[model samples]
Target: MAFRKTLLAAALALSLGVSAGPAQAEVKIGFLATLSGSGAALGQDMVDGFNLALEERGGKLGGQDIVLLKEDDQLKPDVGVQAVQKFLEKDKVDLVAGVTFSNVMMAIAKPLADAGMTFVGSNAGPAPLAGAQCNPGFFFAAWQNDGQAEVLGQFATDRKYEDVYLITPNYQSGRDQVKGFTRFYKGRISGEVYTQLGQQDYSAELLALQAANPSAVWVFLPGGMGVNFVKQYKQFGLMGKIPLLAASTVDGSTLPALGETALGVYAGTFWGPDFQNPVSQAFVAAFEKKYNRIPSQYAAQSYDSALLIDSALQKTGGKIDDKQAFRDALRAADYASVRGAYKFNVNGFPIENFYAFEVAKDAQGRVSLKTIAQPLTDHADAYAGNCKY
Candidate 1:
């Protein structure tokens, strides 16, 4: 009777698959961004794009369920640090991603590195992180802070612009922008102005720029500052009179907000709405359909970050616990990038194409970025040589 009972129990367990143990550990990723304040739109775009990638994969990465923890830093460095602490201590996330501003990124990067956490940058690759402070555990799905401006600067030099005025907020990224431009642009700079970070009014700056009598103006203001600067530029009747060149000042999300004021502005970026690759087309289509608007470069980079993470996880067979193995998988970067043919440099920053973009009205009368030229072909950041790793 005992033997018979044992055989019956074994059959029941086999039929029900009760011998299978608990399910796999959920892969948790914490996304910290400036989800509130002036950079809110940019941060929200990134979050949307990241989530969209996960949704397309049925909320699974490498056959493991994914749990995403999102927190708002309010564009404050101290607040970003606090969020990092929570993500590390409370959420117990396997990886951390997203930092829309360089100031916040700089504040939180060391803490994450100290904890031996894997960080995939969606935006805001500060110069220090890309150079002397490069960490093996860090990977960037976005360009370094200076790359786009470097392209613009090279274009300015090629165009033979004699006197140019430069403006950026006083911050890590701003300094990087100036460094990048001065590296490529041989023109005499009329002024190198550093405004307060997140400053609303540019009237005083604009008046000063007018006095400089620059043949062209270059700006790296992003988010709300871009909107304010561009709008004021138009209001001050300086739009068509002086050529406005920029790096993140006028982009997909900001262009819509700036409307007709942003028209004819020349900018440089790694991704455009009309990028022709198959993967790029698919991402742009899905993003527009889901959000009822075109995705910005910020969104495209975040989307790529999620896909890169998925590819790496799959390569490691979902064994993210093995940090070095996971890092190696990510460094391989085997997935298709929406930016097309992207690779990581020695410093873990992207080496990719940078294009010249002109803001124009689409057939549907929406302000958008049109790829006019490829200024920087297969460009890499300047800080890679300084990286010890």
Candidate 2:
């Protein structure tokens, strides 16, 4: 009779949306990130940064041994969906982590939520996730799809860049960027251009840009696309002749490839390699030491994701089976984020400061990003109010 009661209790716990806790002091997490083709550097940084955080604790989180199952999304929505399904049906991970693009997140979010899975995303927060379509257990550690774009808009306004043109890959995130920029930009838009997702050559686009002859151009190109665009822009003699602004175009991941050509390019972000704070300083130093390269915003966010999981597990006494308990601990957000100031909004997005960065040569004559100005302080997203859950 006692044995029967034990089984019944376990069954009851499972039915009530609570985790029964792992049989052993072990937690399995499925980590998926884009790791091939065009934007692979961004994906590699995300994986390496998250691994560094785990290694710091001797491959443990909250006193429990962590089993990380990694997958490469290949930067495709269909591929990402398949990887996520494997995590659900085969690995049975306690939580899912690391998505490089918003499209992949959109493909995987619903299925994971439907399976009562907790997705601790480190990058790519689509607007709907912060608004009407929020999932109960989905948490994005990075800023929303529009967060940096909104900052770019404010930066443009502060600089008084009139007749600013826009260019981005034609995707949901691309559209979101334009929308967010227009929200705060008080200037006339010279034009808007959308290109293919992984377009390598921007020669044609650059020709059109020259014809437009806008006072300034703001772009959302990232990874190889950013490198190609900047190189072509320079070849077209538009680098210094026209003011080029962006959010993720010339970042740590692509800066090396761009070299001096990417110099003087301004971008907006919530954190950078030069972000000053003890926690951030340590992370940046440790990351550079291990990887021998400056960590990108993607890396910073993924590192935070690892910290978030560790902190939440600690709060739960190393128990991740309790769904609400784990989520609540995550909501508490007890870890010292590398970004210095970070808090999850009601929709599980962040409200933080944003800054404009210029790629400059430091005293050592090494290329690095220098924070020029703060565009937005304590900024929250516009769609959070509409989030139902």
Candidate 3:
């Protein structure tokens, strides 16, 4: 009888302990981007921005211990898919963030969504994803890929540039940029060229552009491709003659390497150093002090992305297991964003202001973007009409 009583008591104690112990409350987040190769610069900037936000939040997001798994996709679709799978299956990350390339974003969107993971896009904004194939699980923290380009196009038209040459990488995002630019620009398009995506050599295309002799050149090349193109355009002595107008690439990410070559160029974007918002100013100051360089728009977007996730987690009391509640919290746009007042469109993309910016040197001998004009005031992207949910 004594032995029987002892065994029953031990079993009861074990059961009680298992039942009373607190459940694990940690949240795992996966950050996927081109952390290596040509696109590394943009990826590093994004990582820096996200880290800064995490630090500001005391290294906790949504009231839980946030674990970030960083992966390098190398700008390839297959690699990106594999990275997302690993994050979803192997690491069991609850959310995935920071995909910079549109191609890569499309490659991983469905699978990540199917896994019931929240995928927040910090940069890439492919039109198709925004339209018919839009998923509720996918949220774009950055502006639509073409919204900034539209600002540049309208600015060019306003300035009365009769003839313009447009060039972009021959990819979905690149093609969408040209389309977006043309939507607002009413001038004669002397040339519209779509070059091979990730092609380093722009000499042949530049020569062709020179032959066309357009009044101005508008381009959309991000990361190392932008750096190489700007350097080569300068070497060909086309900078002064053609009057380069760009969208978020020339001065945002490539300025550090291009130096004086990037000066006097015109770009259109949603964020800049002179945005005159308290959140933006503080972010820029903090980033510059930490990295010894001006944070690009890519960095700004990523910072916002991290903060949004953290804010959503806070709303849920740091519980990431409740997918529906988390998604609702994200849709509420409850976080303080660095981009002033940012809200999500019906399609779960950002509805923000677009600014025309000029690359200029300040009194402190630093290169930064100055606001030249505001094209879109509280604008929603064009694809919002297609979203049923």
Provide the global lDDT of candidate 2 against the true structure: 0.89
lDDT of 2 by residue, 1-389 (tens): 99999999999998997878855578999999989988788888889989999999999988789999999999999999999999999988889999988888888888888899988988888888889998768888888889889998999898888889999999878888899999999999999999999998888888898999998999998788899999999999999989999877888789888889989899998898887898889998899899888788888989999999999999999999999999999988888999886788899888889889998876567677889999898889999999886
What's the alpha carbon RMSD for model 2? 6.5
- How displaced is residue 363 in candidate 3, in Å? 3.0
Order of candidates by lDDT, top first?
Answer: 1, 2, 3
Instruction: Evaluate all candidate structures by whole-model CA lDDT and list the values in order.
Output: 0.91, 0.89, 0.85
User: Each prediction's TM-score against the native?
Assistant: 0.95, 0.93, 0.92
Runs with alpha carbons beyond 4 Å of true place in candidate 2: 1-24
Best model per lDDT: 1
**Candidate 3 residue lDDT tens string, 133-219:** 788888888888889889888899898999999989998789889989999898999998898877799989999998999989999
Candidate order (TM-score): 1, 2, 3
- Give the residue spans of candidate 1 off by over 4 A: 1-21
TM-score: model 3 vs. ground truth: 0.92
Q: Assess candidate 1 and give its lDDT.
A: 0.91
